[model samples]
Target: MSAALRIGMDIGGSKTAAVALDDAGTVVAATELGTVRGDDGVVDTAESAIVALATQTGVAPSGFASVGIGIPGQVDRGLGVVRNAYNIGVARLPLAQRLSARTGLAVSLDNDVTAAAIGAAHLMRLSGTVAYLNLGTGLSAGFVVDGVPLRGAHGVAGEIGHLAVDPRERPCPCGQRGCLETVASGSALRTYWPAGGDHPGRVLLSAIAAGDAEARAAYDALVAGAASCVRLLVLALDPHTVVIGGGLRLLGAPLVDGIRGELDLAAATSPFLTELELSARVQVLPADSSAAAVGAALAGNL
Candidate 1:
């Protein structure tokens, strides 16, 4: 039972990942599992992940120093409560308290995007300001300034997705029109290319290759929206790096290249944007990297 070991869990809409970090902050053991929906199901799923990591590391769950969780939704870190996480069917839950009571360890919670931002800075060994743009089920940005996450006064700092930038004014679930999210996210893809089905990013490239006009249009909009986010982050935060993360990042190099290309195109006219070097600062989160989970663990220590 190593008291130095710490646990971090990232509970996503469809998947859950857990990792155990050694005293030196290196990941020693990790596991992934399907996330179960609803309050009890989420708790059970988290407990199962803890058990799996504990077994792998030959340490009891209670032996860990603390449990940190990165979850989607409005997280009340002070209260250890999460609400409005509709993707996982968690309307409201005292996640940290529940998990702590179950595991007999301290627990902390962070917004999933903020956690990823912190993890990206740590893993990439980046210093100075870093802005993490999450292009996933929804669009959002997270910031880490000199290794400290900027969660803002009310925890709504990086919610640029709802800015309503589109002239057409598409409706958003947040009750807004023309939100950047409505044009950029996975949900946006589903709406734009309904024939592509639930997970559009997976099949989008192939569809583009097959000459599907609709798919091409949707992909183009996604690229444009993402580029807009990068530009917005730079103009606002002037971050040293802007790391693109989240599920759509699975689209890989093509997606990154498209974003850079868009930025370059925009910079072509605006010397202001050119000097900022927006495209050069962009980087993609590595595939299969447990950034959110790792960040969760780090957040616990902070």
Candidate 2:
């Protein structure tokens, strides 16, 4: 018998990515497309990704046993309604039902981080507890203890991006001041950025390396911002290892060292830091990253 095939769709703020995997977890096909703006855009983009994957792989959408979606913004997976997707103005949209009707496949839906963490864990295929931090356009996290992503009491537990860090900083979409997103995200970098520049970490690190006092100052602030995040990670959610993903990770040592160095300075006695430092367990997001989309695709198996 031909093993069943599962289709996974990962929709983000600006693009849609999809993958088809056989029972063996081999990717049958992969495709990506641009965002379809507005409510109609959601359906258009989803249909496009679905059709592209189906057509390219010679796999009928109906032939798939399961389909999963990892979406930005709020989702009520129990009912398959996207409560409030800020990215594309998709509010209370019945995503699962809509897609299921179109593809004739059982659909699984979840937050992007939840999906990404799931995929990353599966890639590493680790046994113990693992946590994933997505440093995407914004910051978010998901935890998988023994291969299961914890959905929390309300199924919305890991909102690490919303962790408040600064007292005198800007507010967040969550109606709070000093959230981690305010300082550490690509969105935050736009505020103080010089136009036509490289990535924030690259520019900042360059400045520091070149002995630019301004760059040093910027680096100091970034380290402090990241320290605030690491400090909280130590106190609140102590995981075996923190997997850092997103464009910011391209900064490499500046990203890892800055966080660890500041964390050591602020949290002298943290077992979490001790464990990480001792084990060298910190892993950065690779240049060719696919964990998020893959995790979104595997949500049904979870």
Candidate 3:
């Protein structure tokens, strides 16, 4: 029999990325396209992207055993629907069913961060408990235990972005005050440095390098929120490793160092925190890795 081909797609607010992997999970093809809003537009865009990828790679979509998708929103995997994905402007959309009908392939759908964790774990060959903290346009986490993602009862187990780390009443889109995303995510940094241009993260980094006080403060807030996230995860799941991914990972050493410093400071205050060794357990994935797409594809196998 031909090796099973698994297709994975990561649907983001601005762009959509898709990849095809062989039975062994090696990427055989990949492509990207601009994301579209609305149910029909989104489905059409994904279908076109997948078809284009298959054509580019000289493989037919029907040849693939199944398709897996990672989307930025609350996904009801059991129902094969996206309950809400504000960034992509989707709500109550039957994403998996629509894609399956269009592509003639079985479909598996999951939250982007959750799929990313699966991909990261597969790529890193990580066993035991692992946490994937995504610091992207927004912030959230995905936990994988023994190769399976913990979806929780409501499938929101890792929605740590809205955990309300700050009490100063900073408004969040989720109708909350002081959500971690309000201070720590790419969106938060952009709000802090609104004039930072298109790539706010890079702009903020440059400003920090130039000793810009406001920029520094924003960065510090990000560090504190991120550190709190790790602390909470350590105390709750106590995962073997906390792998940091997403757009914010682009901040590179500065971001990692800041998080480490904050964790270290907290560790010094309490031996119990010190025992967690969060700094040592944290790992950063390369910014360019297609973890979400790869993981989405792997989701089909699961």
Instruction: Report the lDDT tens digits of candidate 2 across residue range 63-114.
Output: 7678788887777788887767877777768888887787677887898888
Error of 3 at 181 (Å): 1.5
Q: How well does candidate 3 match the true structure in TM-score terms? A: 0.96
Highest-scoring model, lDDT: 1
Q: Cα lDDT for residue 112, model 3?
A: 91
Lowest-sum lDDT 10-residue window in model 3: 1-10
Candidate 1 Cα deviation (angstroms), residue 127? 1.1
Instruction: Residues 196-225, candidate 3: write the lDDT tens digits.
Output: 665788778888788888888888888999
State residue 277's C-alpha deviation in candidate 2, in Å: 3.9
Off by over 4 Å in 1: none
- C-alpha local distance difference test of each model: 0.92, 0.72, 0.87
lDDT string for model 1 (1-302, tens) is 57788888899999999999888778899999999999999999999999999899999877888888999999999999999999999999999889888888898999999999988888888899999999998999899999899999988889999999988799988898999999999999999899899999999999999999999999999999999999999999999999999999999999999999999999999999899999999999998789999999999655
Q: What is the C-alpha RMSD of each candidate to the true structure, in Å?
A: 0.9, 3.0, 1.5
Instruction: Report the candidate with higher lDDT, 1 versus 2.
Output: 1
Model 3 lDDT at residue 47:
92
Q: How many backbone clashes does candidate 1 have?
A: 0
- For candidate 2, what is the lDDT? 0.72
User: TM-score for each prediction?
Assistant: 0.98, 0.86, 0.96
